[model samples]
Target: MNIYAIIETGGKQLRVESGRFYDIRHFASLKSQNLSSNTKILIYRVLLICNEATISLGQPWLKNAIIKGRILHSHLENKITVYKMNSKKKTRCKFGHRQNSTRFVVDSISLNGKEL
Candidate 1:
């Protein structure tokens, strides 16, 4: 049976599964702490969990649900360019931005302190 959960981070919701790599917005906690690869992370904002036969849903978030993962790396995403032009005024502006992101591997999902 496969187990997966929906987790919220960096103002976004993501569907995460065990033994997989996912890239999400950079975590502020990681920035505060000097962490390297394989550092364990516990995510507590889980919205739902499914284990093939049974499903558990939370009212906003499950109280005892947690998702465990390990940080692999932190990097910046591709650059996005924004351009503004004024018609007949001969004025133009352009800027590029790259978003910070982190890559991690999901290790397990636990509910009520028990791994699923």
Candidate 2:
């Protein structure tokens, strides 16, 4: 069995596994610094983690849990169209929006006093 963790990011919960890549909402300001493909970051908002038979849960977030990952790239999310119409009032509105997001590759997961 493999170890996995549940994390909260971008107002959503995601189940992430080690050595994999996932897309998450962008929260960093990269306007002043240059980024490379190997730049690493730490994610600390771990809610839960299960390793085979042992399970760890946090009231809100684990105090000493950390997930190490590297930024893969940043891109715009898919455009979503919102349409509103009224039959008798003759009102119509259409709008489209695209959200900024980033991709990260998980490197490792560690906990306080233990390593997995």
Which one wins on TM-score? 1
Local error of candidate 2 at 85, Å? 1.1
lDDT of 2 by residue, 1-116 (tens): 47999988777899999999999776343431434566788788899999888899999999899988888887889999999999999999999999877888988888995767
Clashing residue pairs in all predictions, respectively, total: 0, 0
Candidate 2 displacement at residue 2 in angstroms: 2.2
Q: On residues 6-101, what C-alpha lDDT tens digit does candidate 1 reach at each position?
A: 998878899999999899886655663544677899899899999888899999999999999999987889999999999999999999999977
**Alpha-carbon local distance difference test for all models:** 0.88, 0.83
- Residue pairs in collision within model 1: none
Instruction: Score candidate 1 by TM-score against the native.
Output: 0.91
Q: TM-scores of all models?
A: 0.91, 0.84
Model 2, global lDDT? 0.83
> Local error of candidate 2 at 83, Å?
1.1
